[model samples]
Target: MGISTKEGLDIDLYQNKGRFLYKYAGSFLENAVKICFKSRFPESGSKRIENSSGVRPRMFEIDCLVGNDAIEIKWRDATTDGDHIIKEHTRLKSIASSGYKPIRIMFYYPNRSQAKKIQLALSDLYAGLGGEYYSGEAAWTYTEMRTGIDLLSILNRIANERGVS
Candidate 1:
């Protein structure tokens, strides 16, 4: 055999591509979620196209024509592991044989730990350069979506076990 190098199966890609551009990544994932809803929604008539409003009800309307239910998009870099990403996806999956699909779109971010969390709290970040939602409801349950990896889920699970005690 010849001398082997670690270049082929190396996992150091993280070091260089650490922080990702959420604006770019969000656009890509937005397209992916759009296609998913379009295909899964119930086909009462020919499918139509539309854009995003960053709300659940907006997604539910399309689900009526198709079958999708919701769309959750996330942009991350390095903190959220690939495995954790997949696990978090099951939040909307069916557990019962007769259960309906509650999920429309569940986008994920691969590595956004040390960066800003994934919640829709602050109206705008980076001194408002990234922008924020100026209209509509000021506070929704969406605030809980702020956790990075499993922090949110784990906290929820524990609190649930306590049963408001």
Candidate 2:
């Protein structure tokens, strides 16, 4: 990191902070959703299952497991990487092989065309596997319906409290 000027150093620091903030925000949202699910389904929590697809990772983690539903929660996924679909496919298969129905809940949908295409593919993949995928408004509705929690309203309140529009 060879930054000669103060402006350059500030820019680099800002970018680094942005990246960290993105990760923290995603984790925060995911955990919040999991907590809501736990409140509704006291026995449900994260689960780790062995990858039956013989993939690189030997294990796949379900964000929240309620009954036969293996849930994967995401605040947002904007990955343009094609390999992401492959990995997700493997993970969903592993979850299904564990005698559970795979369900994806993504709170935010990416605006990029490539990312949107990826999400569409995932939705189709889930449907093909007899699973379910929910994103954006549908994800919010599903969470509220399943957990009896108004997550969007709660988030809006928190944002208002934090002086974030």
TM-score of 2: 0.89
lDDT of 1 by residue, 38-152 (tens): 4444342222222232232222222222233232333223343444333322222221111322222223322344322422222222113222221111211232232112333
Pairs with backbone N, CA or C atoms under 3 Å apart (clashes), candidate 2: none
- What is model 2's C-alpha RMSD? 2.4
Predictions in order: lDDT: 0.31, 0.92
TM-score of each: 0.25, 0.89
Taking every candidate in turn, the Cα RMSD to the unseen true structure, in Å, is 15.4, 2.4
Which parts of model 1 are misplaced by more than 4 Å?
Answer: 1-20, 42-68, 75-107, 110-165
* Model 2 spans > 4 angstroms off: 1-17
Cα lDDT tens digits for candidate 2, 18-94: 78867887888999999999999999999999989975798988889999999899999999898899999999888
